[model samples]
Target chain A: MINNAGPSNSAAVLDEGVGPPSLSRLSDADLSSMLLIRHFEKNLLKLFEQGFLHGTTHTCLGQEYVPVTVTSLLGDADHVFSNHRGHGHYLARYADAEGLLAELLGRAGAVCGGVGGSQHLLRERFLSTGVQGQSLPVAAGVAWNLKRSTPGALACVYTGDGTWGEGVVYEALNITALWELPLLVVTENNGIAQSTPTGQHMAGDVRGRAAAFGIAYERFTDTDVTRLRAALQPLVEQVRHMSRPLVVEFVTHRLGPHSKGDDSRSPAELRAVRAADWALRYAAAHPEQFERIDAEQSRRVEQVVAEVLARPLTDWSPR
Target chain B: MTAPRVANDLNTALHRLFAEDERVILLGEDVCDPYGGAFKVTRGLSTRYPHRVRNTPISEGALVGVAGGLALAGDTAIAEVMFADFVTLAFDQLVNFASKSTAMYGRHLPLRLVVRCPTGGNRGYGPTHSQTPQKHLIGVPGLALYEASPLHDNHTLLTRILDGGVPAVLFEGKVLYGERMFTGGVIDDLYGYDLADGVARIRLHDPVPPDCVLITSGAMVHRTVEALRELLLHDEIVAEVLVVSRLYPVERAPLLSLTGPARRVAVIEESTAGGTWGAEVATALHPHLWGTLASPIRLIHSLDSIIPAAAHLERQVLVQSGTIRHAVKELVHG
Candidate 1:
């Protein structure tokens, strides 16, 4: 099918959001979850500056609404395959902020016993890999199994626009279409892949790619969780009951660097990205609920940081 | 009744696995009814278990990935990469994802996945079509390497892989498919085999003390046995033949006992020399077999070059029985 939206553009603003959805109407639970990821990511960058963290991390700052809303659409049994920048994906599913921070800090109570670090996290029903383009096939296979073993539960995988270059992505998509596995491939197309922008890397748009395989394609140019969920209710049901594979691409922005201090964008472009942040938009629309919940989530993340830091380092040995 | 062909036995094993369990899935290119498989090892399978056996597009990478995913989701996934040479296309999925998924993810997930590759050269299929790439996947962690030989039962081997519950790569030599199954504990009418140790130990029809042992696997076992038979008859030198199916995680006790009696042993394979499985076996055995009064563990392999399409050149590039005979005669006489 052709793209449900107009000519696909990766950098289209959320002001392109349908129904002009208001942020003030969003439930307090949803607002808290998004802010929890927001402050958690900001704290991680601060940790690196303060010399408290090692290696590197990819924070899903501007793209927090993708996982927050997508995970809400899924049930507990549905497998969530995350990518290198997957802190929001994990937090949205498990809500275990302390364990995730411990994983990054390599502390004793780390989620993966401190072995997976920030990128390669593995919890029950949720997994994240540091590699690109490999998770789609794995998720497709799991979806095939879920179709047989546990009907109605689907497999959802998160990837970036940069991952379209991987041949395995097409390979997985081809069979997923041929076999009709219940798979939801969510692409967080933030316009730029690492430092190279999408236009430089991708030839045609993602909609055409999905059309080539006959997979259902949907695009979101906004961060309206409630409205998006209401709109997606019937489509998500089709993915589960009809055993159809869907590609939901979110045209969002990377408010933070690709990894850590690797933003190659001009200063003007970076300022534009900051201005489009859902946090800033939410503050402008719902000041009372946004200020209270945002501060509370920020304080909660700081407490998690302090508590996870004091713990001893993880000493892991395989059996 | 005629003896079963190697391909038929494998086909039967796949059918049996699908019949025994509802979760067993076979994925491959042209695996379904009309095409069966390139070598017909999966013949008549999709007809019997249509939903369980699937025909995939020409996608080796995703083929292995889907198999790994099915295995991760608690299904016995068996995938076939048409020819062994193409196994290289699925190397990353095999090593990085399928192999690592077992242990790297916080908890243990039993990936009952098997990738079957029709390996080795002799039929003049040329460089890309007839190469043995099993050596590349031999030592990957959490992954097992196996081969199907005329002397072994496919059902037993496939069952063992499933029972172990780890991802495995089973190499089926291209030339071995048409060969008759060496059944009834006898081989080539000149040697007898003992499968007591889960690996075949073939010796003369009657008991005789041997001077050295030739360690080989898969289709190459036939050549090694023929060389040993010739060494006993013409050269008056008796050399034992130890045929291994499970190539990786080499078992020490059985190997030492089989080769220790002769004190002189050589590892033979179809892969080219430099970084071959023969070298790994020789290195692994030398330390334990030290001071046993032998020159050194010998590694007999094909020349380090691409296999050519010409039959004559292929024979020269691959290790022939004469090469094995020469290596053993030198070890015995000198």
Candidate 2:
């Protein structure tokens, strides 16, 4: 059985041979990627607080594992459409950190030429937008094109439980299933939307919602990297082979508030969630590997920050 | 080169485009083989290009969003919105996604998507169905806006837009769909005009020295042509008619050059007077023509009211030949 007690208990559950897989089982590359995302987000939060970054940012502080593991299963040609909370997704796709940072700072050197802030990041195969549920249909459209042009390629859309409330999600799901487009709809149900809890915003279960559209559904309560990779690899393969849409609702928690402005969670709740930080727990369980990876990620983040700071700031004025 | 009706010309354009490029895909509600389209503009397209032309559900947002996605994925897509009013349902996709994608991405996203909207009144489809919503789409940066005119070759225009490598919204006047157009001299031997820089000018009388210039587009071109004939025959007033095809990015040089020594100019359209295309054209022309004008440019348009279903009421509310004639006469005789 999977450890519902959270990431802190994941190591113990694995030692007892009771859970799916443990974070200690992740490859060096996978662990390094997750560490890089975590370090990058932490530094970004500092920059945001220092007023170096304009516009509000939605950080994926605790939800790094979901995107890291999911993106690992995807090939470079495959497309990814993400929602507002998409920093982790961008980093996982190996987007230039300097460009992403420049964009958040509203510089001309931004990936989107400073037009799209933190919420909207677009590479060749990766796209994210500020609007909720909008990317689902966009993913379906991309998947339709992939179905026609690139036979083996697939499209993945990362939405949230709050996005499930949007009517367009259902419309996109229906069309994706009807067309049998190769799409994977990842609902990162981080248990909250802005300030409201998921229960307040979501009606009915996500599994049932997927079932209504006659698509396959999977729920991952614990988003430990190894467990996620193990559960997702075969599913992604099946989706690519079958050329159909699948829903993977990841039930997790946000380590930080929704944005820089909102800090409304109770102290006890915050402490409890922080104690269950997956990376920290994994580090405690395996100290040597965690230290090596963490140090390397920290150095990389520091190097990127220094290099980006040394460059001239991009002009924010319209061309 | 065939002088078919505007609808048939559009069909011919689609047929040719499908045959030429495998990347071109046509999508909309009831645009399949049996249904073709509500206006039959996409007739026989699906039969010819079976998988390329697709019928979609009644979801306007998805239809447009999917078209944007297809374009981003390197396929040229043309989406047909049944009516201009239904374009409201697709504003998020067209304005937010399609228009802004390349700019937001800071790279050319290959968003070669065209949204075809059938606009205007006269068939009495009422307020919901017959609005000229092109005005709402005008000021959006990075979006190209075009209106089909019987005066210009729509086949060539469609081909140019598809090859233009941009996101565009093309408005086809519903009433003008069945109207026939020829290259020259159908109504009069003096109807000699050439399409230059997106503007087509038909002089009412050759070597007669136009007393005034009347500017219009879409179905209004037909009414303005008729009105010009009346003005020349009855009132002996020779006015040059300038029809604009690219509604946005209004090509001012060609229009101002063709206006040529005429002090009075009248701009007419089917949409409401407030913030209409006529207003934009007049605004653009004011500074350039201010010193040379005899009087202020005359902006003639429909009243700021919902288009009614009744024919007489619709006539009163919309710009007809009588209104065009009156507006032109006032501009010339004032």
**Which candidate tops TM-score?**
1
User: In model 1, which runs have C-alpha deviations exceeding 4 angstroms?
Assistant: A1-7, A13-24
The per-model DockQ list reads: 0.66, 0.55
Best by lDDT: 1
Tens digit of per-residue lDDT, candidate 1, span B1-334: 6679899989888888888989999998988888899899999988888878899999999999899889888899999999988888898888888888777755566789999999999889989998878688777888898889888899999999888978999999878899888888888667888875767888888867778888888789778877887898899998888888988867666888777656788888989877667877887888888778478988887888999999999999988899899888988888
Candidate 1's TM-score reads 0.96
**Lowest-sum lDDT 10-residue window in model 1 chain A:** A1-10
Please, what are the lDDT tens digits per residue for candidate 2 over residues B1-334?
6578999888888888888889998899999878789999999998888888888888888888888888888888999999989998888887788887867765555578899999999888898998899888888867888999887777688887877777899999999899876566444565667778888878743557888888888778778888888898899888888888888867789888888777889898899877778888988898999988899989988888999999889888988999889888888888
lDDT of 1 by residue, A198-238 (tens): 87778888999999999999988777888778777788899
Superposition error at B88 for model 2 (Å): 1.0
* Fnat for candidate 2 (0 to 1): 0.59
Residue A257 displacement in candidate 1 (angstroms): 0.9
How well does chain B match by TM-score in each candidate? 0.97, 0.96
